[model samples]
Target: MRTGRTAHLLFLADATSVHTQRWVGAMAARGWRCTVVSRLPHEVPGAEVIALGTGEGNAQWLAAAPRVRSLAHRLRPDVVHGHYITSYGFWAAACGVQPLVLTGWGSDILVSPRESRLVRLLTGWTLRRARLITADSRDMLTEIATYAPRARLEQVYWGADTDKFHPVAKAPWPFRIVSLRAWEPNYHIDVIVEAVALLRQAEPGAAIELHLLGGGSMEAPLRSLVRARGLEPFVHFHGKVDEDRMAALVNQASVSVSVPASDATSVSLLESMASGLPVVVSDLPANRQWVDAAGGFVVPAGQPAPLADALKALLREPRLAEQMGRRNRATVERQASRRSQMDRMDVLYRQVLGWTP
Candidate 1:
């Protein structure tokens, strides 16, 4: 399925994820024939998604292997890449394709493995079959070393589109604080809400508005909590927005927050910084790697008091916010450019396909 310029990529990933779509679109735009095989139906602007129509859990994934292998036989893709090593990676490994690339996205490596010894063993088994392994965070890559060879692994960020996410003219009035993460417990959406409440309590009539973006299982609970705190007027739920809209929201904000309990490098954090907004993130190693002292604050993982304090510091000093914003913009451009990272991936793909530059 080679297009004579780039290799056809058969991706085993969650079709619903923006990360998976972006990967598919980027490669397709580069003249590669891309097809995604997934459990759910979804679309990419320039690629194909083949829904597996199976149930969730280990059994379904195991059950879907024959069909996935059949697709590979017909497609004859130059590379078979899988995202989220625990699920899709398992099927990719089962299919026994050559030049396989498995990407361990955050929790599949960091959190999921700790669930049990069998999960870790399964993770390692899936990883060993890959020709190349990639992850966004250094900590995730470091952890991947325990399962697979360090030589085959690379740190590849799910980068932010710097061009599309540049800063826009924003007002201090309404003082919007956007959280780019979903409402899942992994992201601790309630913590951000609690911090917003604290901010209003400490300084009433501050005109602060909390924008909660992305939808998840915790929506009902979070909404109830917001109502319980009497933050209905102040808190807005923007459930599951597209990339363009998400960027606009980020650009219009005074600040951004992402307090995920665990994450690889966050695309939202990068996008926020790219849009020249100083971010407040959990004190995870991956978060620290990006949000340096100048970029934003690193508060305790689950504590709202420290997060509120960080927000207060930024809101109180416009000059300081602008300074941090400048620093953040510079940092993202240097290290987290979407184009540059994708180009790096192109090189890796070329190498795997044994194509000379």
Candidate 2:
């Protein structure tokens, strides 16, 4: 089923990001041969997966560059696309591949720049070697330019499956407010818990419920916080649901909340918009770029009181929440459609590979 002329795309990333799975699946649907090489296994069907090892960080990558070069030569890839500019991109670039597309995923540009001198230098080297660098948001692109001004940078938002996530009839019983993100410190799930507790106190008789989906290291701590706060009846944690179930849960929610400490572009927020749910998000630049006053409420970060007020306001006014949800859904239809994102990526990939679309 493989054609000799089919572009062999090597996706370099960590195993955790489902965005890689989505992109690889989309590319495969378009008949491109995709192979994912990373530290962990991906659950995507029809895409070839090769786990290069867990501890294969920059140091290991530096030493294994020659081996990776040999593998690349044998595979003879048409384009090597790295999914995280700092780590994976560094290795991909050092392995001597042409038409290298480096994709900077949030923290690589935002947090990594503030890292040690060695990391910054390595990131710079990776960016310099890239044929083109793609970021998920304009904020991320701007951050990346501080280090690699000469590199070709493109802002490509992670595409959400509108068809899968579109508006559904709200589920009856227990009005759900969901947070679908990794239970990491950066994501600030505990903040959501605190806010939800405050919201419950404000509306004592309200049937409001908080649904948390996804797993991470912070799960234990978050759970302890929930128990300590006596939010057992109101808060439910459904750890890492499949896409279908996740979409269903999104559809069931009256409002979706994400109070990230920092972000480039959030796939969860985009998906929430696509699912036609009103959002209450942190007022970070990245979130503000996606959600405005017209679409969702953007509150200050870390403070649970303001966030609780926003949630309570939305809950008190059902019509307002519905209107915001409709606007959010419309925004996704206009801007963040998967087809549009894929179209842009296709052009960028072709340009990098010197192929005519």
Candidate 3:
């Protein structure tokens, strides 16, 4: 594969999403003339943006098809890529875009299709329309297979920026546990709060703190749980922070925890690994694809006791935590660094375009 090849890519996605922004930026940097056609327009340098401005609903998507078709005809991009198969993928299919590429973002494939018969059938139809489909994890790829076996599937991770997330000079601080997972229903962040309380009970007078890094529908209830457990002093709710602050927080933290009920390859977990923090992740197949005993402990999800025990062990054994962090850094450098993954993605793009390898 070579760099600096001229290519045009039209992307359909929720431009407001950070993931979308990151993907667009990376793709643009690789010398692609990227144009983002999104419902909600977001600013990303080096790429053209087109806002659909259509209000949400099935009716809106149907209405927007002609507009999308007109735009596609005008641009005539080499490839049409859509993120989140549920919405963008369907839109791309509806617009009759050729050389279509669809990327499934976790719940869109795992949860949304099960909501209704129409959605399941429509999702399968959309999958059949795509020339290539991508998933962030092998588990997700398998799920996508159940819907579209004939659709070409590739497991491509949205990996972490290792240079920005690399280990920093460690300063003496309280044993800090950081979770970048959203405080949402499936994420079970409240379970982490409960785990903290259990840790307090198990270790009589351990100096520890928990940093909840994202906000969601479960924020109020999780805060209430923290208060009820009298964990105000030890738990901190940091709604959300920018990328720099996120890197700093992860670098400072002694351990990271991510126990989502279902997930793909989480950028949070990869960032923690690149930042040289020991992780305690859920034993979900998606998470297991990246995290193992070598990087961190894989505890059973939704179980506070086992979760706390994992956190406690990391807290108790500083050497073990440091050892695991070192291993994690090495693993990420080899497998999940942003540059390497993006290079592989570029190869995929070229392959799809039938460019000579």
Candidate 4:
């Protein structure tokens, strides 16, 4: 009976990130009022974006907390939600809002805490401040438990819009591969390029095309590596794209590759799966939760030869790839559909505010 009243959510998150956009967009579509406070430049359709700081480094992030609390005081939102445990999470905590919600994106809980004792303590401070906390993976939840032993928590997938990402009729024998991760060192984009070089050698007769989506500081180095490996004609860099464009490119491919050095459940990986494309991913504990032999191949991170070998196997067997794609789609429908995850979030919001019809 959530028909009459509306919940207004104030979020502190990356305005440019598609993940943040999905959260705000979904809630907005449900007729809830949404406002985002971000340092970055971008828009989440249907939600208001409040720019903070100069859109730069760590100092700006740290300096914005007091201002954030002031904003919270004025906004008086029904829920104050923070996306990213180490940064905005701190601000959400400082605001002293009732029913504060914090979501620990992968690196914050796993990588950042190990940076130093100060970071570890700060992370704990944010976790302890929130009435409800969410993470996309079990390992993330386990790490959250370490920081705030008694914190209430939930597993919430960023998830894929199944309709947008679902398989499209394509050239049955298409020899295209797509990588949607950022061109960052941790993501091992170079390894994917090197593996593609190996894959080219393994399948010299076939016309293999590798498409790299998204961008970062590693772009110049990755392009140089592609040139050095003589894969210029085969690998295409499309930079960052909108959801519609991302879905189009993903559907145009025969398979997807995402071998990051570390990760939680990736929205890109889930989107690729929904598009009915077999994936070759890293052997991370989080990846193991989603990809398996029936769905995709998992290889050691930063190892080109093994990754290339996995890619080669998929390249040779279109039928096997197609079968794997089906398995992946089924898995996503059962576990990572965006609509379902949004429903879970809706329930979480109600529980947090004690809302009823």
| lDDT scores in order | 0.88, 0.83, 0.87, 0.89
Report the number of clashing residue pairs per model: 0, 1, 0, 0
A best-first ranking of the candidates according to their lDDT comes to 4, 1, 3, 2
Model 4 misses residue 318 by how many Å?
A: 1.4
* RMSD in Å for model 2: 2.0
* Clashing pairs in model 1, backbone N/Cα/C closer than 3 A: none
TM-score of each: 0.96, 0.95, 0.94, 0.96
**Model 3 agreement with the true structure over 244-276: per-residue lDDT tens digits:** 889988899999999999888899999999999
Better of 2 and 3 by lDDT: 3
**lDDT for model 2:** 0.83
Clashing pairs in 4: none
Per-residue alpha-carbon lDDT of model 1 for 1-357, expressed as tens digits? 344455678999989888888888888888788899989999876888899889998778777889889888888888899899889988888777888999988899998889978778889888888888999989998898887553388899888899988887777787889998888998999998999899999979689999989899999999999999999998989999988999888899999999988998999999999999988999998999998778889998899999999999998987788888888998889998899899889889888877745
Better of 1 and 2 by lDDT: 1
Once superposed on the true structure, which residue ranges of model 1 sit more than 4 Å away at CA? 1-6
lDDT of 2 by residue, 156-191 (tens): 888678988989876444768999988998888998
Off by over 4 Å in 3: 1-6, 57-59
Ten contiguous residues with the weakest lDDT in model 4: 53-62
Q: State how far residue 4 of model 1 sits from its true place (Å).
A: 4.7
Candidate 2 residue spans exceeding 4 A from truth: 1-4, 54-57, 171-173
C-alpha lDDT of residue 173 in model 2: 49
Root-mean-square deviation (CA) per prediction: 1.6, 2.0, 2.1, 1.7
Alpha carbon lDDT of residue 334, candidate 4? 95
